[model samples]
Every structure is written in structure tokens, then in C-alpha cells.
Target: MASLAVSLGLRAADPLTNLVGIPNYAPAYLAFHFVWAYGILSSRTLKQWYKLDHQESPRYDLVKYGEAAVKSGKITKRQLNMMQRCESASANSVENYTFFLGAIGFATFSGVDRQTVNYWGLMYTAARIAYGAAYVLIEDRKVALVRGLLWWAGNAACFALLWAAGGKLNA
Candidate 1:
């Protein structure tokens, strides 16, 4: 999507340039997807963990379990509450990120005319898949850090690409 957007934008500004090739900003878009995907996959793992810990129930009773765990001295109240809050936040983040991606995709399809932007969008999707897998399966501190850094770098690249593209459009 980002690639398409970039392509359209570039074409609008200068029609002679070929817009099908990958743009420099592709990495940045990839990073954004990486982080978002990681968040989503991790959240799923969290949900699974919650279910396993609480037994196979129709609904997650995290709040109830947390309270009970605290009352029974199995866990501190603060810890229980924090865990619940984290789970809730993770769920919300996954939904929000998915929506964001969908919006970008929609914009690209709606005649935004930027092929570079569309290409970036594809990169973002790939990065996001990797990011999610890493978040779910990797626990090593260094590995985790690298994944996070890559995700951020991708985002930074996207921002720079957007800024550069915007300049081109206006020029």
C-alpha cells in the first residue's frame, strides 16, 4: 500500500519515473508492519497462556483469577492487576494496528496513485509477520532487542520516505 501510494505520488509529480520497483522507503513500512504483527502474535500467545492457566473455559476469567490469586497470597495484588491490564492493552493494540493497516490498504486502492507507497505497504506486511513470530517464539534478550530495533528502524525509514516523497510532490 505504501509502495502504491509512493508510486502514485511520484508519478503525479513526475510521470517519467517507473513506479513498479521497490522504493527506498520500503524498509520503513516493513518495520511498521513488523512491530504491529509482533504485537498481534504475542497477544495471541498471551491469550493462550491465559487460557491454559485458567483451564479451558468459554471466557477468560483473568480478572477473577487475578483477584483470587491475590487474595490467596499466590500473587501480589499489584502483579495480578498489572497482568490483567497488560492483557487488555495487548488485545487493544492488536485490533488498533490491524485497523490501521486496513486503512492504509484502503487508501492505496482508492486511487492514491503512489506505487512506491504501495511497495512499502507490501514490505510492511512482511516485516509485521516476522515481528509477530519473533515476539511469540524468541525469548533471548539480544534476539528480542534486535527484532525491536529492526521494527523501529523500518518505521523511521517509512517516515523519512514519506517526508522525502512529500517534498517531491510539492516541488
Candidate 2:
């Protein structure tokens, strides 16, 4: 009975898990999945921009090809810079996606509150989207700090979820 409860994260003593609303894991998992898919598709779309410019089989390497294009006057520096921002934003999203996925999964398995997990998952998704938009749109270096704040917000949520999971598992 104890093993089954642990495996299913169904500790009868944990009041938070018995919440009336948003107490399932599926919705949180879907939120994470949507962000991951968005990152991959965004990166691919940036690559397609390069393809449009090159027309005849551009190199797959974004950094090298972008630099070469800028040096060779094939593309303007501003264009390369914009592409770099988009690519970096996509890359950041993908990187964070890995950590968020594990954090939420472990938290769920450890019997952390499903409502809390859902809130973290949804908030993290929104933060990543805002981070990407800020990264691309904010030109002023000082004002661009908003992107860093958004990134930290998402990471903080993951850390909080992981911490909660750890505490619950130890108990």
C-alpha cells in the first residue's frame, strides 16, 4: 500500500493533493509540451529565413553561416543581428524546457500538490514566451534586462517545484 501510494503520488495525508480544482498532472504536462514544441518550431523558422536568403543550399550551421553572410555582404549586419536574437531566444527556450520538464515530472511523482504544479507549469510557459518576445523586441541594452528577469522567473518556479518535491519525498 505504501509503495503504491509513493508510485502514484497519492499520499492520503497530503491535503494539497486533494484540492478541488486542477489536481491532475495531464494539464501541466500539456503546458510544458506546448512550450517545448514552440521552441523547436521557432528555431526551424529562423533557419528557413536563412534558406530564403541563400536560395541554393545554405549551410546548416546558423552561427557560422550568419557570420559569413555578414562578412561577405550577402546580408546586412542588422539582419544577422536580428536573426541571432531570434535564434538565441529559441535556444534559451529549448534549454529551459529540459529543466522544467524534469522538475514538474519529479514534483508530480513525489506527491507534490497538483494544483501547485499546474500553476508553476502555466507560469513558466508564460514567462518563457515573454522572455523570447523581450529578447527579440527590446533594443536598448539596459531595457533588455527584462528578458533576464523573465528567464529567472521561470527558473525560480522550476526550483521551487523541485524543492517542494524533494521535501515531500523525504517526508
Candidate 3:
């Protein structure tokens, strides 16, 4: 599996091994890229549905069109909620990408180990995927626990990154 290869490759590389400017976190980066792309693509479903339903003026503003669709009986409450969750997931992914960028900047400036960043980044990426899926697809109360678990995993990864980053700060 590609992930297996990436994990193996990552394990082989030492965080202490310098890569000119930063340690090679390519495996983590690759996973980040894949997850980010999926987030972007996931948002399109709502747009496509809105456009198909509103041929007269297909352009959508979530606030306006979303409410309109539900009111007009064009989409059910559940569908609208799912679409909103998907769109929110996309936005959260962008925020996560920003966090990655910020961490890399902080790590490089502080001389933090690339291995630390890479492993933590990978964890965050995987957790994000699970959290996003739970956010968008599941509506049942019984399954809320699944989402919570994913959220905790992602949150823990984020905390790990922060801790790693803290280790290298000039303070």
C-alpha cells in the first residue's frame, strides 16, 4: 500500500537528518496534499446539486441558496445539513493546511526536528479524514461517538505538534 511505503520511508528518515533547509517530511506532505485535495473536492457536491436544482441562477451563496433549497422543498433538511457539514469540512481542511504551514515555519525557525513534524503531520491528516467523514456522512445520535473519537485523535495530534514546536522555541 502507498501508505505503508510512506510510513516505512518516514521511519527510515531521521528527524535529525537535515534536508538543506528542513528535514524531509515528504511523506507527511504527500498525505497532507491528498487530504487537502479531497476536502476541496468534497465541497463540490453541494455546489453541483445546487446548480442542478437552480438552473435559473445556479450560482450559490450557502446562506441564501441553502435556506432557499430547504424552503422550496428542493432539498430535505438532512441533505442541506449534510452539504453544510461537507462545506465546513472543506473550510476546516484549509484551516488545517494553514496550521501545517504555520508549524513548518515555526519548526524551521526554531530548529525543530523534521521527524517530529512529519509524524505528527501524518497523524493529523489521517484523523482529519476520519473526522471529516463523520462530520459529513453520519447523522444518527448513536454514531456521534465515532465523530468524538476522531476529534480527540486529531486534537491530540495537534497538541503533539504544539509540544514539539514548544521544545525548540527560543523562550
TM-score of each: 0.44, 0.70, 0.64
- Candidate 2 root-mean-square deviation in Å: 6.6
**Against the correct fold, how does model 1 do in TM-score?**
0.44
**What is the C-alpha local distance difference test score of candidate 1?**
0.50
Off by over 4 Å in 1: 1-113
lDDT of 1 by residue, 66-146 (tens): 567667776675555445544544454465454445444443433334564655566545554555455445556677775
How accurate locally is residue 127 in candidate 2, as Cα lDDT from 0 to 100?
A: 80
lDDT of 3 at 115: 68
lDDT, residue 91, candidate 2: 69
lDDT comparing candidate 3 with the true structure:
0.66
Cα lDDT tens digits for candidate 3, 1-171? 534554676434334543324445745575665566464536665667665334454335556678787788877888888877777767666656656566555654566677677777778777877888788898887986798888778768767767776886745
User: Whose TM-score is greatest here?
Assistant: 2
How well does candidate 3 score on lDDT at residue 124? 70
Task: Answer with 1 or 3, whichever has the higher TM-score.
Answer: 3
Model 3 clash pairs?
Answer: none
In order, candidate lDDTs are 0.50, 0.72, 0.66
